[model samples]
Target: MTASASQGASSISSSSIKRDASEMNNMVTMTTRLDANATVRGRRRPPLSRRQRGNLSTLLSRRSPFSNETGSLAIGEFEPSAAPSVDGVARSSLRDARILVVGAGGLGCEILKDLAMCDGIFVDIVVMDLDTIDVTNLNRQFLFRSKDVGDSKAAVAAKFINQRCPWMNVVPYHGKIQDKDASFYRQFKVVISGLDNVEARSITSENPIPTLLLPNRWLNGMINNLVEFDDDGDPLPETIIPLIDGGTEGFSGQSRLILPRITSCFECSLDAFAPSAAVPLCTIAETPRIPEHCIAYAYVLQWPREFPDRKLDADSSGDMKWVYERALERAEKFGIGGVTYMLTLGVVKNIIPAVASTNAIVSAVCVNEAMKALSFCSQSLNTYMMYMGSEGIYSHTFVYEQKQNCPVCTTTTHHMSVSSIMTLNSLLQQLCDGEFRLKAPSVTSSMKTLYMRKPVALEKVTRVNLDKPLKDLMTSGEELVVTDPVFPDTSLRLVVKFTDVDE
Candidate 1:
């Protein structure tokens, strides 16, 4: 293929590849794990010693994921064995590479392991986590043990990896990722996030995390805002950091390769996450339909009334138990079943049990993409991959396009022509019911806040502005900063250009 054609081919996202359960029956499989009494290659394999078991090089020497005897790399046949003429040089580069992992939970542990075990591809790893290991984390977060509970997750995870791979250096940061500045993040070659929260993942975009995959030509307009210039005035490719983000929920998971301003960012895809379902307060209080309604009632009404001074900490075991008990009482009263602790936690915290298998699959894909990004051993995912293991092993890879008016990545302003007589309510409706489809947007201008949707006191204060005309709020052509729950960290800029309308 020609240069342009090759670029196009590499960039195009592939259709969904389904590996049905029935298909596994037809394929021949080899069992790599030796039975305690089993022989391998016509010889009895001795039991591994503690030191030997911990040593990763002993296992990696037998087989590496990127290279096969046929000189083919799995998944698209991008041959790593062929790509690097001098294996020593490539391996050296990989050994010296530094990668930052932004979680030490289920997905984080798996990501760190996968990246570290990649046969000299990554030796310097930095893992960060604000949480301490809870007993609940032991089931899926394989790196932590029951004894390790109440200890810093990042420290324990690092110690575990370092003990196994003596040659590798794993640095642990036992603090919030927000505490670290750009200088701290810029040291790493790649930033791989195994974080569960969207806000933290979005914050990674603001940090030194890089974006790769998209060509500079297509993203010229957007990159100009983010890309740094070299001494010669050319855009510095080194300044563009690549972020490999992966998340798992239950039996489903996804991994994305992002290039911040140069490609589809985490903020650009915020619309994909459906907004939280709003239940009417009356239904929650007077009549309850499902078990979740009871939980909500207990959380929303009972908690605050009982403990006026204290705020509910969802992570607190005491708080969760109290809520669970109250919710259970409410459920029993309303003749509702299935109001268990797990369900209560889900309803209150809005989190599901992290599946170990799903985390492994997604983390492996994410680390693979990171390796490909650094080594160029294969084409990186262009630029999202979704894995569904609920039924069968199914995957869908697609290129997520960037939003033109993306509040985070782009400064593209929106223009709205409205009559001076238009009420603030009409403008709010236009934002919600119109093309923007914004939910509970708060409108503000350079002068004052025309309306606020949150903070009961402020909402009450600004409530009268709803029926006020645009003329009373501000002059025509005034710039308005429209904030919504959709874009949590940033606001949309809408220029209200006046237009004549006869009443």
Candidate 2:
């Protein structure tokens, strides 16, 4: 826990824990909701009004895969009781533990309701989502009513849950996750990511979470060895919580428990995800073969030419229709079949097949993991868990290893000895496309900008450093940030120990 005088830094530092106003806003909102919903318990259990019923039909009209021709939100007929007391002693955390659920979509809605039904930890359940209620979200997103279309999903879900279980307080934040910084994230003991964005699960942060769990002495030891901080630098410690991640694609879904810094972070195996396939311009333009090729041609080439000033949003029905029509036209010329408005929408939006059953199945596990982390009711998921309902009801749990040389978590800094005559350009060449492949590398030390690759202004200023001898330009034991757009996701942290070999 002690800060090293050499650099005013501790063993674990979280530069990523930057403050955000939304965190304060969410806290304040949760307080207000808890006070307001303490008594509104399910006093009314009426069926959906006429207007809500109409919206349900519209939701079904969208060529969605929901087999149900119609839908309705069923109000619970009985009052929800409090959670059973543990060991015959009432545990009030059921009504006091604050849980933040990010995303009010399919899995999000389920997580919110399942947690509410569990009932003891009902004090402050905050929900955040940037989208409004959509007809397409109706089949799986159980908390929304047809009448709630066009309303903020977070707000609607909170209101619905509060009305159903008056003692439950579901606070809603109708905003983007990026708007909140690390300070806001620290307030909650656990965070669940309900997003379908696979990339969100694995990106590395400058301030990782594992250090939060590191004992003070171990952190001190790790930092002393991994980072070379200057005598004058002082860095503050960061707060990190357990992160539960869930993803669903059609009938398949997976959930994982991530303990930042301590376990395999999302960035450790980012290479596991296959890079998206890009259609060659020739195949898309010259001789389109498959239906997907025709769609790509219209989407990639035709859209830009026809609507130069407009951005294509798959959410907009009009926009989706336009692309489908254009793609369909191209397909006709190429004698293609099996193109429809629904398929076009799916292609453009990258919509995965998700079912209500899968959302419920996956969310239950995520909630169980949350309860374990929050209440210590049972051992939390060792690491990762997946569910596949389509083939058969099957679930698998496993622990994944962090990448050995992960740009994010690895403390292995590169050590190299070079001659005094070695120039910055020479150092760059030495790295070459070998074990540590780097090209057009930009290097910087603690006190000075050693070199910058582009943006003429930066390049001009730092270009002088490139010709200077590496030994003369850098102070002994100073670390440098070697970066390139090639990796784009992680920067190389280097501590260059120079040797003057020009004897």
Candidate 3:
């Protein structure tokens, strides 16, 4: 060291020592100490040197298990046995996987990118989304550009990923998810969704397909940590393919690993969501109180009155202005403030606040969970994880109980009794009237097609059955399989019992 530098270091060290004396005095040391009078010796004198020890042990016999000679065993030495190697879930399995992505929008686009970036892993991905590209989606839907505005989002995203990643096999299904049957989804090993629609996700999760479908993605992340064989040689094979679901809203996000029938699924927490407030028809029509009431009045009442045949398009600026004007006038009558165009748009579209950073964070967690599920690299998420990043980052994870009567988890048939004299049309109409809210339902009994909505020939043949008594077509105690366009994923197995209703 230079003379000046050494002197400067010593001065700094002395100053630091002076400042640290008080702090050091207050601290209690945990280290063990020797006696205060312990003396220091330069070096310990060995009782016997190597030459003396060798001479002393010369008379003793060789002690080693192999032989007495130090070099390469004296004569006939036995070699040690080789240790058995441990095997684990291979990345090759992931490379050969068939993955399906539902929704090619914000979260969907990110999922595709994350899955594609899996180094040295090649897999097939099917992208399914019915929606077309919009100018507004450019914010977080990174796959689309300005020129691709009106193109099918699924096609555009699939094309973008294929072009960017030349080796990726991304197939685009430019149609509504409803178009694909449960059988189609069953072809894939994993189905990851980037959808926000509760109904759509529900359908995907519960559809009795063999393919595991994720209803959400994750909000937290870490490096993949997979264990090979444990103390036991051959680990039991995993039977359940987990559904990794995650979502983000503004600064808050979450990801859950759902083992369908085994773990608490999305349906288990369905009851946690507060039911939508019901606006009484009389209040919305006669005594509108707030902006929402006025808006509902314009949507549910005035639209049909103004244009009987035309449908009010929520995406159209002109249609929205009409609703806003009517709502604004109604609000003024009720002395209600805070009714604006943006508010109208939000109310009509049911737009939720979304943040790009939150989506990225949650998407990473979801994708990572997927990797673990595919290769058993690390433990999958216990059940639920939540992330809140607004006021600094915070997260928590917990296990939620699975629902006993979850339709997705259980094979219990849902039974409903209808009047024996009721016509097939009335029976189908009854589904729409009660708690179900089912529309245009089809029915089958013992693999017999009783009614279906498609194909003009089938519709014509079934039209007569709609007019006939339901009891006449099938026995009262028969088991019927019911499927519909509304709840595409839920194929309800209903046991029909005929009875008379007072109404």
Candidate 4:
């Protein structure tokens, strides 16, 4: 067969080969025309053009997504565009939807990239993270590079999305969630979490936006969205929306998702992480704690501050020096080590990345599930966990099997009549008061306040230590009394006297 005939046959058989052949024909035609006069003049052959060189490079460098050189699939290789068809309806639901992600860390960046690049469904994304990039996040967090260390993760991620897919909107929030209240939450049709902690997650989950939550509940609960006038003329929705619940637990991280009435509230989900007898000492040592000199801690412990602000110089050399100095000062003031030892040990281990990544993954899962719920497409109320380790990706789902005699979930107490503001104030007052106690098995008493919320009590409360007054054991009120609690050996106790009732 003629060369042209053979080329035509091969091109017709393969679409990619046909495209290449057409381009090659144009190149050959141009070269022949240019060399026509040169050949007549007996001139030397011309050098290869830059365009031809690039074509050669593309042909030679073509690689499969499964290539060992690339640990991950090349962009767009793994994403499925169309959902599985069932009864002529598409199962993949996110089509031309706007999704707002609260953090651009490990999970946010990955989800944004994947959804934006997927072929079948079009997605618009907005990413918000108050954190600037750090060098320590280079491991499992894939969106960043070495040069992006000082840049804002949110902004950098937005720029990346813009460059890769200008069609998608990847907005960034360089500030905290508290900076963006209801107005911010209402802007997006769906909100996704890439947050780091329970506090942030609670804000996104609990925000009462009609667009997200109302529609979500209406759809998921299979209720008609109609308003009804009651006997007293109070208008109410015809149906109450159910909550969505999800959770994830892994060796590196744990996450819980509560969607209004579907699962538990954010507070209710705390039961999964509630202090149990199975919790170990090392795990307890890792929880974030307030410094002993914290005014709140002093108030709770009823002691006066004897040390300056427990700030550390970034240039300090010893791993434990910053902690040791803080601990020693706290020990002197409170007559106990307080959380200084845990803080010091955490510094030594530098588990910030692990915690941060764990948080990031949990946030991502929570956000994705939230979007699913808001889009009226959620499936289950189980907790989803993502385990990233040498053993590979392992996910587990859990459901709250309501106990017949459970104290927290099954109680018959009346719904509190307080407004949202009053409820929050009451919780805060209770926390500050000596009566409604707060404690975390993982954190010292000084850190207990961090975990105080109406939702936390729904989970079993493991009493780490009983409140003991230093005045009871001291011989004289004039002398400073310090002693360690047998329970939380990491903390110290102190008592101070005030003659005036206000003091």
- Computed on alpha carbons, the lDDT of every model, listed in order, comes to 0.72, 0.64, 0.65, 0.42
Model 2 TM-score on a 0 to 1 scale: 0.61
Question: Which candidate number has the best TM-score?
Answer: 1
By lDDT, rank the candidates, best first: 1, 3, 2, 4
* Cα lDDT of model 1 by residue, 1-503, tens digit: 69998777665532112344335534433233324338788788787787556643343333355432222222223223323322445566567778888888899999988976876558899999888987668789999987898899999999999998876789999986645545666677777888763311111112211211111111221222344767876557776677777878888889998876667777577667643334677778899988888888887889899999999987688999999999999999989998999888776655456888899999989988787667555556778898889879899989899888876567789899999999999999998766565657898999998899889999999999999999999888889999875553467899997797432
Candidate 4, which ten residues in sequence have the lowest lDDT sum? 200-209
Backbone clash total for model 3 is 6
243-340: candidate 3 lDDT, tens digit per residue: 56666667887887765455666656656543333456777778777777788778778999999999888868799999999999989988988888
Which structure among the candidates has the greatest lDDT? 1
Error of 4 at 202 (Å): 21
Clashes of 4: 15
> Of models 1 and 4, which has the larger TM-score?
1
The residue pairs in collision within model 3 are 216-245, 216-246, 217-245, 217-246, 225-377, 226-377
- Where model 1 places Cα greater than 4 Å from the true spot, the runs are 1-87, 197-226, 229-235, 303-322, 418-473, 480-493, 499-503
Clashing pairs in 1: 210-241, 210-242, 211-241, 211-258, 211-259
Cα lDDT of model 4 by residue, 39-139, tens digit: 53587667667654533122223333433223221111222223233211222344445566666767667667655654424346777777777655666
Model 2: residues >4 Å from true position, as ranges? 1-90, 145-150, 197-240, 307-316, 414-443, 450-479, 482-492, 495-503
User: What's model 2's overall lDDT?
Assistant: 0.64
Please tell me which model should have the higher TM-score, number 2 or number 3. 2
